[model samples]
Target: MNKATYQQQFTTEDSPGWLAIDDQLDQIYGDTEPRHYPPLCGLHYAAGGSDPIDGASIYDSNHQEFHRHIVSYGLSELYYDEEKAGGEFSKWGFELTFRLLPFQDDQHDPIWAIQIMNNLARYVFTSGKWFEENHFVPANGPIRLDTETEITGFVFALDPELGKIQTPHGEVSFLQMVGITNTEVEKLKQNPTTDAVKELIDHLKKDNPLLITDLNRK
Candidate 1:
């Protein structure tokens, strides 16, 4: 379903939440510690039986001794970038971080979901993003690693009324992502059922035929 076909969800229930996602991805995000980590989103991987095993259980299974999921990625010290803005999104940029669920549930891998989202972004926007992984500080714009005491991360919403993007790190506002302005957000909030939004719905619907941004998904 496209944006128009998608029902707006005000409740915190997971059903509608999943409906808004290109793929219902919030579950694999792993709800623990500091609230946010890396990859704001994850793929649903690792399964036992036909039933799904929880993420925490998988974390404990392998780390049995460390007793902490902090270093699961194997980085001694995590570096924080001082820049927070990018390309045209500088003034409105935000950072999202998350954790890996580390367990599998017979569904699909979070990496695969990442691949899907990347492809979806390309298919929908015709712009290549969601894959331009940046290392070190961004060449231009704001880049700042937010420091908080015992604070992991949070899913940010530029315009809460529009939609969201879940990352392994945190959630970002879907509308604000592609250079959204106050005027646009206000319009979206006031008239979600407008024709322009309907057009978005149409676009999403037409994207189901599988447009390949990368052919290496094996």
Candidate 2:
């Protein structure tokens, strides 16, 4: 949006950025009430809770196959701050996303993915670091503790379906975190470049366009 239009629109709205995000999700999910996890108090992270992300929304997706699609809020300027009107990018310019293959246990949900996003958000908020497309992070152990899985790390890419959107606050990219094996992490470390990571993602995308994180994959 243009400078004048953006200012006129967002200035009056209580949470234009938040609404914009919801609208984008609406296009895809269409009234599907996602399983949302928010803090007990207001602005959980700011109010001193473990989750830095304001909220985490998980939806059952069947784009390529059955999976859980998780998206994070609060990584960007979710609420209206008059001072931050229409810049090049949002707060961190991106929100974390994760696509995981459905777990076996029907009794439990995939809250672990939410925790991982919060941990990453904490790192960004505390250390002033940010992630971009094709970035990789090591988990030190299996991504899901106590689980026998080869996925020990993560590599980020633009969420295949969500991609990116322009909000009244700024632009936000849905950066999806895909699970990877320790072996893949080692390969990324050897090169440490965006292209190298892209090469890895491209190969994975051939069969899995959405790059869903299958914990059982070796």
Candidate 3:
């Protein structure tokens, strides 16, 4: 179909990119329902709120390890738009994904991770810079504010499972967040190379494929 014709018929219901991402999540969750959290006020660019995106949390429990997976819904062209639709890469090219180790007795997904994702979204929206694989950023303090967690920063990596997908908007990459301690963050700041981040992730993956953020890492 011609671009004009396609855009005319496009509606939020016809958001292929959004649907494709949900489908991928459905495949992973199967019959389980993920806990979804939409921004209470609205997106930052529009409403000037703290959170600029929607978040969904899913729990994965197996013999090997158990963790909570959180994914964001803003970072890309989520809906159908002629002007921003169809390109070599999705809106900003990637969506943020995070895996956190869940406490055995935990009853609900940690809201802190969602806040972290929103802050990152704020940085991108305000700075016009996008995050990519191997890119790292300092949290400036404890990743979980007011908490004594050793995780002080994060690095981006292609999600080992979700990886990337072709959407109507373009190529969307699932950039997973890997927590890094103060020492590791310093190493990344000093080197700032893709290989340096890769090595750190490789070391992390030796324990878990999801690369769950270990807050207590010393």
The C-alpha TM-scores of every prediction are 0.21, 0.92, 0.87
Would you list the rank order by lDDT, best first? 2, 3, 1
Q: Whole-model lDDT, candidate 3?
A: 0.78
C-alpha lDDT of candidate 1 relative to the true structure: 0.24
Off by over 4 Å in 3: 1-12, 42-48, 61-64, 103-107
- Ten residues in a row with the worst lDDT in model 1? 70-79
Compose the digit string of candidate 3's lDDT tens values, residues 76-193.
Answer: 7777777666577878888888887774334677877888888898889889999999888888898877776778999899987788988777888999989999999888899988
Error of 3 at 95 (Å): 0.5
lDDT for each residue of candidate 1 in 1-218, tens digit (9 for 90 to 100): 22222223222233332232223223332343222123333332222221110111112212212211111110100112122211223211222222233322214333332332233333323432322211111112111122111211111122222234442222433321111223333444565444644443334226311111111111
Task: Candidate 1: list runs displaced more than 4 Å.
Answer: 1-111, 120-172, 175-218
TM-score of 3: 0.87
Per-residue error for 190 in candidate 3, Å, reads: 2.1
lDDT of 2 by residue, 163-205 (tens): 8998876899999999999899888888978899999999999
Task: Give the top-scoring candidate (lDDT).
Answer: 2
Clashing residue pairs in candidate 3 (N, C-alpha, C atoms within 3 angstroms): none
Evaluated at residue 82, the lDDT of candidate 3 is: 72
Model 2 pairs whose backbones collide? none
lDDT of each: 0.24, 0.86, 0.78
